[model samples]
Target: MKSGPDDLAIHQKIQISRRTAGLLLGSCLVRPAKVLASADPLTNKIVVRSQLSAGDPGRLMNVFAKAYRGEPITLGVIGGSITVGAFATTKENSYAGRLLTWWRQQFPRCEVRMVNAGVGGTGSMYGALRAGKDLLSNTPDFVVIEFAVNDNWTDGEAFEGLVRQILAQPNLPAVLLLFMMWEKGGNDQEMQANVGAHYQLPMVSFRDALWPEMAAGRLNWSDYIVDTVHPTDAGHAAAARFITAMCNNARHADLAGRSGATSSLPSPLHSDAFEHIDWRDAAALDPHENQGWHLDFDDKGVAAWNAAAAAGRIAFDWSGTGLVAVFADPLLDPRRIRFRIDGASFQTLDTLKQPKRPILVLAQDLTPGRHIVELVDDDGGSGRAAGQQVRLIGIAGIGLKDDWRR
Candidate 1:
């Protein structure tokens, strides 16, 4: 709730603009002031700045109609830190929670279930790998995808692949693309916009709705943004407002009987090489030997391994052309591991740099076949020394063949 210098500057500019508007109107030199006050400024701006092209509601209208008649509906949200409610005081104050609240208010008679599948510091690459097990398992009737900021570190191909994977689900859920912004006004919303257009998905943009207000001094960045990237409680509320407004528009608009089916899916705008990705925890795989490793379970039921001693080996077989090893890269006193695939050259994965998050990946692309993978503790024969504790979390496979571990 502390206003920074930038907030002060914006406040001053807003006061000046208001004074000028009042003066111009007093002289009867401007349009009627009633027009400005007729609607909430933020809501009006959102409608005008909306980036929704191909405004077909598809099966979303049908789902809304069902909900209105007291049918059960599930809403799923997937993304990175923003979706995880990083800066929000609590998960209930996050945008996903706010949106769910609105849905409940709009359809009080319906049973609404919400699944928030958000992982911090990850992009579409990881999202694509985990969607099947994490988000799609809920069989959502409606899903909101928010990866604009996170996808900045990824390419359009990966982003498109994630979108396609969601759309291709057997449930044929109504998918909405949400583009969130950073405080410094940087995001990959435009890049993902191309993919949204290709699929004619309803796209809501927080940046498009709020950036203009911020620039014109009608809104201050500090009023909503908590940091350079994450949103505060008020910021999440604003995002929820924009998303709700978009959905309201879709509800009121004519549906034209368009079904949100994969049959209508257009050709991919970029390669969906990651469409077949799958994720598995290290503990889930049957290890060839326990050696110096032991499984540790977190409160959330996620399993990780502490390979504090050297020469720990765990072997598994997977049929995939490419593989990515996911592990814990601690911020303090990190460690390293030597990974060998089918007796290939040993590749050392060092966690010397501070990890932005607990999860990290070491990926490789190989020829398609059943391959053996082994991880060896490379702590220089020292056991749990200052920087010699390595933890293995999970692994993800890309373009896996039939014999791939399920």
Candidate 2:
């Protein structure tokens, strides 16, 4: 019998199209077996590093207790979907959920309460904005930040703001930055490392370790990631394993033996540079039915696009005539789209004109360079559909290049 899209595998494939899938890959679905190393009773002191550097001979015993088995320590986790476990079937199955479970098991006597503060598509700007209420309000003993995957655009200035908010808590919470990844763009790990060192904090680079593991058979990339960007249940488990291992190692360090010296850790691995964009709703552009305009091809599936159809290109470019548009047919609120670019902003061919329908203008006259562009609904305004009112078909453009065709 032939299988249909209703198959479990097929459904999993469809789920990967969302941004949530990418961030939630490394939770706790795949639990790696623990290898207990014999404890060293003589080891007492450990040298603690101010940041992500190699440290003194510290004992991981206490860390293991604190992270997994210690008393009812309240851990507050904040970030985008990764912390929320978007791909996971439920919140209880998320990394945060699993970590709390492991903490309970590791320290049977301890009570663990986890506060999850994750909002999809939000950046550090949003993280900082909500820290007081979402994170600090609970007075957590420790906080973990995982904005690396969702907010690579966060810079030193943003880091300062985030740090200030996190430090404002009365407990002087221990902060852990877990650097995550996307398919491409700016070195997100680098950004995390810089921020971590500036704050003299502990940092974990899943991207740094996972890239090499994916290359080796020790770990399966497919088990962890559904796409180049997101992770599968297996992938999330792999992430959980990495975090567990790191925590285990930290606990095993002999912190009592170290007098008081600190070391510097290397910056997290850098990713390719990406043109940063702050999503916004733009006035609709003219929808032309000109013969010159035609839909083109796009590898990334068009979900929140102006229109979607396999028969035609989901996007288009005008042939040097200087204009084009993906008109809002049904007129949905929060009508938004993505336009990838390599350099600066491009010229808005229809800057002077505004159409009755909703649309976003992705210009082509800005920085001259390579760029991948896509349009997505910014989750802003709202409207209903009238039997496919939006059109992704190519309408018109003034001076577009031949290479711009689908």
**Number of backbone-clashing residue pairs for each candidate, in the order shown:** 0, 76
lDDT of 2 by residue, 70-169 (tens): 4567778888777878786666667677766766676677777889998666656556545665777897776778787765544544444565556545
Cα deviation of 96 in candidate 1 (Å)?
A: 1.2
Q: Which stretches of candidate 1 lie over 4 Å from their true place?
A: 1-43, 52-56, 255-264, 298-301, 330-335, 350-365, 380-388, 401-405
Q: Pick the candidate with the highest lDDT.
A: 1
lDDT of each: 0.71, 0.46
lDDT of 1 by residue, 1-406 (tens): 2556744654454344334333322343135545755654554434435434423466577678778679999999999999988888887899999999999998999989899999988887778878888998888888889998886655686678788887888767888888888865678876776677667677777887688788889878988797788898988987887677656655654243435433556777876657767677766766755677888876777688777566778776766777766666542333356777788877665532324444444544677767778888756644365653566677777776556646
- lDDT over C-alpha atoms for residue 256 of model 2: 29
